[model samples]
Target: MKRTAEKVLSVISLVFTVLSVIGSFIFVAIMKTFTEGTLRTEIEMELYADPELTVEDVDMILSVLEYFEGFSWFIVVVLVISLIATIIGMIFMWNEKNPKLAGIMFIVAGLFAFILSPTSIMLYIAAILCFTRKPPLAAEDQSFIDNQYDDSMRPL
Candidate 1:
């Protein structure tokens, strides 16, 4: 049985997952730099001029950046997990071997990374295809199929 659609979907989903991982790393890097760099000092200098802004507010903003930056690493971890699942599924799919297992992996990975829309959507569709597609039944010989003889076992 051919698994072209499943293969395509899995590859696309993998690509999207990879992109998401890269994006998360980029975001984390930017956040780290912002918190550690002179830009933070610049922001503090500007904020000090405001009459209503308290130290607590500035600290809160910085803390938020720190928290979310760490949080982005979690996102990367999730994406990497999904990426591994998809790769396994692709391996099974490409060989037309154990499609059901591949489908399961695809679905699990998709739901696991549901926050990543593109990755999840492609995997979901691919999984649907994998689960639904079936191999054609083998053709029977016409003579055997049309035989008129009674082949039933008889008790003499």
Candidate 2:
């Protein structure tokens, strides 16, 4: 059993997961810079252009930017773990060993698959294929059966 499709999907998922982790880092850096920069103050002033904007609301918005940046590290860590799981699954499938366990690993990785629907979808499909696919049944040789019949000589 080659498991070509599953292998391809897993590799693709691994790449996507890596990209997602890198993107998370970039996102956190950008958010941190935005929070600390004068642009934030400019944006605050712009929002205050609307006389209806209250001090509490402005403070909440500023705090949210910082919190989002803080939480992005958690996202990066999750994505890294997901990448590791995906790689382990790929290795198992590549060697055509322990496919059921590989599928289970994929499912576990899919739990936090980097917030990318396509990547997660690919992982899930790979898992399903691993679980449901089976090798073709072995066929007995006809020539051997004929030789056995000739030796027996008596038939019902």
Deviation (Å) of 94 in candidate 2? 0.9
Report the lDDT of model 1 for residue 142. 75
The C-alpha lDDT values of all candidates are: 0.84, 0.85
Alpha-carbon lDDT of model 1: 0.84
Q: In model 2, how large is the Cα lDDT of residue 35?
A: 80
TM-score of each prediction: 0.84, 0.79
Query: Which residue runs of candidate 1 sit more than 4 Å off their true CA positions?
Result: 144-156
lDDT of 2: 0.85
Model 2 Cα lDDT, one tens digit per residue, 1-156: 778899889988888888898999999889878788798888788777768889888888888988998898888888888888898888888888889989988987887784457888899999999999997789866665555555657666
The candidate that wins on lDDT is 2
Weakest ten-residue segment in model 2 by summed lDDT: 143-152
